[model samples]
Target: MSNELYHKCHEAISQGRAILEDLQQWDFETIIQYPQAEPQSTASHLSTTAMPSTEKTTLAEMESGLKGCSLCSLAKQRKNIVFGAGNPRARVVLVGEAPGREEDEQGIPFIGEAGKLLDKILLAMKLSREEVYICNVLKCHPPGNRDPQPDEISACEPFLKQQLALIKPELIITLGRFAAQELLKTTQPIGKLRGQWHEYEGIPLMPTFHPAYLLRNPSGKRPVWEDMKKVMQRLG
Candidate 1:
């Protein structure tokens, strides 16, 4: 067989293997809940004040306002703009970079394989999706799941800020490098950012590896669990 065909065959086999792996039920027992500790004070001057006022006071209003949004080219090909889901009045808000294939299809955040893993992680922390608000930095999916462009983020960030302003969550958890960097406005690697407590708009923010990363690197589960344990302890 030619080299090109050989590579294609290998790629197909790898994709099939990944599909099979995704289909198998993941073990949740490994996601044990570590004991929570008392929330500690941070010297970092980040405040707990609410975000600046916006026209949209309620999530409903925000969603309605975003209808037919065409601020960026992403809206042109997107099936739906993922407005987000979960408790509108949640104390904790989970933020991701952007929508993926399944998220774009369903117009929901974190509903794919990575989402399933996130559900398990939340369960391990004795939390449910209903207890937290989930959203993304960009409402629309980038073509081929590429990194969000600067213009796209600029167009979409205001809506996200408005969402946070309305929700006024006590704490925020950012998933993955892009989510963390974009919100924090820093270029620090996730390894350096994770396992540390940061602040965003006066709310305590924690950065951790995305569940999709955990799927690819099973060893990352331990550190992500450590991060969640810190979150639980902070909420206590």
Candidate 2:
């Protein structure tokens, strides 16, 4: 594991555990603080002339649509759009939450420490990155790698929908809570939402623990692997 990933996972685990200690004494609303996004980048004006009105029919088309996209506030701060990479006609598509620091730097999704683990999971299923399409719910990395805000999701959702339409994959796998909740349109926690079959735009969808989560909680790897088995069978 990279030092950055290890440290992040460690911190998240520790902080999460600390919160659990006070689970019984929680006052729900105040405990969950929604942060207002400060000006992370100079806001840019979006021209509808550049935006795609009709559905994009190819990866190239989707790329064109995102080339200069500034529909949401994330556009100004992003290094690269992180459009997605893999077979355009892939049988499986995996959606993650948002680009992390490494991902933003590389302009690719799932190329960090968590991404390496995701590769192993794919290998376990007798697959490679070439066989599966990988992307995020949002194209841009959220400032500070925080959860994507509502406006960000709304702006990015159309692109994701376009990708799914073009690829027409047999299955879609959602990596973490954010992707799961966004795609499922639910407020339930990941613990309650994962390990079940869901659907999106007629394609079968599965929600599982993200590799980052597994990195922090090694015990989670087993259940994630179990989910992969089901994925393998479905692919066959």
Candidate 3:
């Protein structure tokens, strides 16, 4: 097998082991709840006026309508807008920072190596991609895989808000610093934000390290698995 394939297999094994350990330690009766962070202000950047007319109900319709969007400069470089995917009625939604190279190319959210890691994580939770919707804060990828700019997020957040309104998910998991910070409207770093419960538009939100970060720093898998356990329990 190629070196890349070999490393991926090894990483999977390590992650699986961590998951098993977490499961072994889990107690169905004894709930371990983290302290709730301060409630974030519910003031939305996107008002009712920003919502598309009632005619655009389905995600497909919204995506189609946004085909020629040039709300931000990122649209200029994007091959395709990585619109969200998975079960429309999914109880959980995973939001990341923005589309990566692979995601941008495929016009699918979380379809890259990070996405594979995410699939493994969902499996660990006894969940599948089909069970949860996945998308990013920014649909179009930034140039050179850079961090999303404020203007870009401002231009894109309305659509994300619309998506949440449609999905009305029971819970949201924000991956990476940007996703968590942006949604919560906080300046706290991901390290402090993660492992604690927060809220977004009344739905429970959990912030955790992104799968891409875990790939770079495999040691982070343990904490991420812990976070997933909390998510599973909350969902149940």
TM-score of each: 0.77, 0.78, 0.77
Candidate 3 lDDT over residue span 116-193, tens digit each: 999999998888999899999998999888999887887889889988889999999999999999999999999999
Query: For all candidates, what are the clash counts?
Result: 1, 0, 0
Off by over 4 Å in 3: 1-55
Regions of candidate 1 where Cα sits further than 4 Å from its true position: 1-54
lDDT of 3 at 151: 74
lDDT by residue (36-84, candidate 1, tens digit) is: 6556443111122122223766898778667666666776789988989
> Model 3 clash pairs?
none
Candidate 2 structure lDDT:
0.84
Best by TM-score: 2
lDDT of 2 at 29: 18
